[model samples]
Target: MPCRPSFSSGFDGTSDQDAAMEAADPRGSESDGTWEELRLLKPREVRHLIWEQVPLVDASSSQEYLRHHLPGALHLPHGARLQQLRNVLPDLSQPLILYSNAQNRAAALARRLSNLDYANVYVLGGGIGILLALQDA
Candidate 1:
């Protein structure tokens, strides 16, 4: 069998309206009791954006980050550190991209950032694993 790439969207299980609902109130995107957009990006897209954006964030553990991370990726530990991250980051409006080792931590983190009024938060589809798989291939 030929090797094929598989992917999942952060919005796979919900309607756009549902996602919008999630953005309402304190669901996800409502730092100031409002809503924002969560942009989903492919690994390749993130790779390209890294050069100009400098907003790549790795939300994995310190060990995983030390082992591997995209070039110029800043480490934020995880979703809980987002508040402190606000202090560390100079511009909240800067295009922020997030990724994790596996699963959908990137998506979760992206939503959390959206809730915190980040105007440009993006989740890396398939996170770092897809990058590794594509890199190996």
Candidate 2:
């Protein structure tokens, strides 16, 4: 969609330091004891993978999701019942991004997903709001 933000990261090669810096940024996620694997992707980075058919989940309730959400995002309720997520997401190794309005619920889901062995779960940093602003820009 035209709303896709331009990816400054550009899916290009990066140095090991770049990786370390990204990992060190505590803004996106907290250490959850399971390898600290949840990544927080900015709108631009998320846009880079938008066209790649990466799976995205809207961790908001169904009602909230129906009001607005990413075009291809799946609706997976958060907390205690994330097995539904496991059933929907078959591979633990594939890249996955989860988002809600401001990422509160999304963060919880990301941590749980990581705990469940999904190694590549990422939270949309500012959620759909940032995506909208980027699209407008």
- lDDT computed for candidate 1: 0.63
Instruction: Show where candidate 1 strays beyond 4 Å.
Output: 1-37
* Predicted structure with the largest lDDT when compared to the true one: 2
Tens digit of per-residue lDDT, candidate 2, span 41-116? 8665677677777888889877788887888787887654777767888888999988887677888888887778
Model 2 gets an lDDT of 0.70
lDDT of 1 by residue, 95-126 (tens): 88888886256767777877777878877655
**Model 2 poorest ten-residue lDDT run:** 9-18
List candidate 2 stretches off by more than 4 Å.
Answer: 1-37
Model 2 has how many clashing residue pairs?
A: 0
Residue 59 displacement in candidate 1 (angstroms): 0.8
Clashes of 1: 2
